[model samples]
Each structure stands twice: as structure tokens, then as C-alpha cells.
Target: MSTTAERDPGKTQAWGAHAPTGLAGWVIRICHALPGTSRIWYRLTRLLRGPIKRAPVRPFDVNALGMELRLLNRGNFCEMTALYAPQFYDVPELDWLAAQLADGGTFVDIGGNIGLYSLAMAHRLGSRISIHTVEPDAELSARMRFNAEHNGLSINLAPVALSDHEGIATLKIDARQRGQNSLQDGTANGQADTREVPVNTLLALCQSRDITRIRAMKIDVEGHEPRILGHFFDNAPETLWPEALLIEHVHDDNRLMQRLIDALGYVEQGRTSRNLLLSRASTTGG
Candidate 1:
């Protein structure tokens, strides 16, 4: 087992507020002494991260030395074609989520990339809470399903797209890196052909499925969060709202996001590294 001392020197320096100078650092310096090793090291490190599995809990636990996470990714879903890396969003997001759990409620993960938090909820929390994971990418959806099975979990995976309405929509896929937030808007670099799918409002889908009492939600859809949020608010009952919302605030759209969330009647409650977690007023009559 690697102790904190034997671990990466950079992390040790970061924790101690000191400059790193050690055998590992010297080795790295020597490696960099060789021509082109620096860029090669950078590229290699960037290419593979981990589903670095730890002891199996309910949802799979992983520590890439980034953040401690309890979630699932397809065992086959290794990081390929660099793209946008999976950040530590799930760690704090899941911690906050653990705090917000209502005894037996539903948790919906819109734009669930690869079942990280969704699987965590199912594994850690169990059947007390229902889980609905929605991912548009077919490959990612497959991976999510695989991870679910790998963990013997029973999460509902919606492999279709979710939007304001039902219709044929062109899904702009960043084919080279499917995990990067691909959009329906035709602006992404490697968008593919239009695929039509039925779009259903969150409330409508919940009602149809007889779902009640939502505990929390995690939404990361690059820049389309505003639109998805708008539709949810438009259809949701004023009283029935998520206890917490962990959303990605990617661009410098603070004002825009505030306006949109305000339209939904959410006040900024808190923030994690790249996400905002909001809560409804407790005083509001449910």
C-alpha cells in the first residue's frame, strides 16, 4: 500500500505549501533532460485516468488521486481520445447529495455522463432511493449499462435525448471524445448526423413513471443547461422541486445562469469547483 509519503511529490508539496524537490522530482527532471519526454509525459498522463477501482461498495468507488468518488463507469469505458476529462465534480456533488437524501425518493441525473453518481446512489443508498440516469451518447449509455450490470445495480437508464419537446433533433457528437459535453446545437467540432428522439419534460416523465419526491439532481450538459432547466421549471409543480441541484456552470455565464435559475425560483445556495448546488426555500409551502 502506498502511504502519503510514497505518493506523488507534487500532491505532497501542494498539501504542505512547499516546493517539491525529491527523488521523484529528480527522476522527472532527468526524464525531461531527454528530448521530447516532457510533452510525451504530458500527453500520456492526459490520456489515461482511472476508473481505478477500489473496494466494491454499492456504487463503485474510485480514487484517481483526484477526488474520492463512489460511482460507476463501464468497466470497458477506459479513457480514450483525451477530450474533456472527468473532473472531481462527483466527490463534492455526492457528498452534498448524501446530505440531501430524503428517506425514499427519486434522484434524476440529467446528462449523466457514465453513471458515476447515479451508480453511487444506487449502490450506497440502495432501493430506498430510485435512480434515473439519462445520457444521450449511445456509447456512453452502453458503458453506463455495463457498469450497472457489473455492480449488480438496477438503475433506470434512459438512452434517449431529453429536451423541451419531442422531435427529430440533430445530435452534435464530439465523436473523437464522446465524454466531452456534446451539444444538440451544430457548433461542436465533430458533430454527426441528426437523430430523432422523443423529448419529454422532467415533470411529464416523472408523472408518467409515477415518480414523486425528488431528492436531488446532477446536470452537466456543457452549455445547454439553461434550456433544460427552463423546460423543467416550466413543467414542474411549484411545490415539487429537487432538494438540491448540482449543475455545471462552465462558461462565465453567472448573470445568465442566475437569471435562469431565478426564473425557476432557485437562489444560489452553494458552489463546488465547477458546479453550483442550489436549494429551494424551506419556507415555501410544499
Candidate 2:
């Protein structure tokens, strides 16, 4: 994989030019220091979308989940939202997921994007745990690697999409919204740009890495969750199951995946705005 600096010299320069400094640095600090201010700043960003979009991609440095992260301010919604409101970006879900690894174990982040969840767990758990972040997008995966190396954190990155079968598949890329990229077929919506990414099942990934015990896992594979999780539940041994799971429920239809999880001995512990928090029945006293 090519380094970010090698792939885009201009982006490397933008990193220096857009470093959170002076007024921008002050605003970010204030947002972190004062509760609700981040939301206010987010609202302002929405109000000034035109100028913000027209400006070059900026970088914002902030302490999120106890880790100092340099987040990009354009293209990717996850990074942009985190840049604007680190304080409120999935705080409850992150807290709950982080708490599950208090004792120390492996954490897996599917569709990791820019490694927000994986990096946070690494920072919080330090050397006590291992992290595996899976992202197929070449650019996003490179950014994730850059962020991990930038922070001097160790994270195993798998640049492939996980599905029910092992093969090559088409991934729809929404350049403007990188997080919305998916493995589903057809471009009826006119999303012409697509990439062919390698696909593997969850069991294959865990087996290859010798990951027999997972403390927690967060999977956000757009709308392909059901296929992946269903295959894992059917093929993986009980010992290989994660104690806790944070599954993105926004893409689920009629709560189909939630019902499947329930049938597999996982109980819903809670629900965030975008994810359904679940724990193995034995672990959660369900």
C-alpha cells in the first residue's frame, strides 16, 4: 500500500496548511472544554456548508476517547462529524464498547472507515489488547494506517470486505460520502464508480488471525450485516463468538438482523442512534 504522502503530495501539504491552529485550534479546544458547544459548532458548520465545502480539506486535532487524533474535515462524514463534534460523536456507544474490554481481549472493527473506534480502543486499552480494523477502500484504509502510525499505535489492518462467501465483489463508492460505500450489487441509483474488493467470511478472518476469543466487535458493513453475521453465526464455533457486539442497525430492514441475533443467544442490551448494542446471553445474564 502506498503511503498517503506518496499517493497525494497535495494532501500531504494540505495537512500542514490545515493543521488546527490559531482560531481554528481555539474553537476546537473550546468545543471540547464546554459541553454542548461542539453541537453548536456542528450547527454552524451546517449553516456554512457552502464555504466549508469549497475550502480545501482541513485537519482538526482533538482528544477523542483519550486519544489525540487528526481528523479530516471533508468527503468522509464520519471524520467530518468527529472533527466538528468529538464530544458527542457516538459517546454512549463508544463508552459501552470500551467498557466491554476493561479486562483485556481482542476487538474487531468491520468497515472501520478511518479507524475511529479501533484507535479509541487501542488508546484506552493501551498494550493490554489487540485491535483488527477491516476496511476495503484503498484511500480510507491508507488513511487508517496513517492515523495509527501517526499516533504510534499498533493495529492490524485487513484491506478487504467480509461477506458470506470468499471471492471478489463490487463495492459502490460514494466519493462525497465515503462511509456510505457498500458491497451490494447494481448501480440503478447511478453510482457508476465502483471497485472490486476481495471478500472473506468472518470465520475465515478469525481463523487466519488465530483469533479464537473476541471480547467485543463492531460491524458497520452498510446493509450487508445480515449476510455476514448470519454466516458467522452458522459456521463459527461458540468459543469464537464475541462477548459483545455493536451492530449498525440503521441499514437493517424491519429489524431482521436484530431478530436473527436474538435467535442466536445474543440479547439486545441497548440501542444507540445508529447501532444496536448486544451481548451474549451468558455474558449479560440474559
Best by TM-score: 2
- Quick one: RMSD of model 1? 12.2
Q: For residues 33-72, what per-residue lDDT tens digits would candidate 2 score against the true structure?
A: 5564446655755544444444565555556656656666
Per-residue lDDT tens digits of candidate 1, residues 20-128? 1453234323432333323464444333322212212112233321333323222222232111123322456677776666455778898877677787677777788
lDDT per prediction?
0.55, 0.77
The TM-score between candidate 1 and the true structure equals 0.64
Lowest lDDT 10-mer window, candidate 2?
Answer: 1-10
Worst 10 residues of 1 by lDDT: 50-59
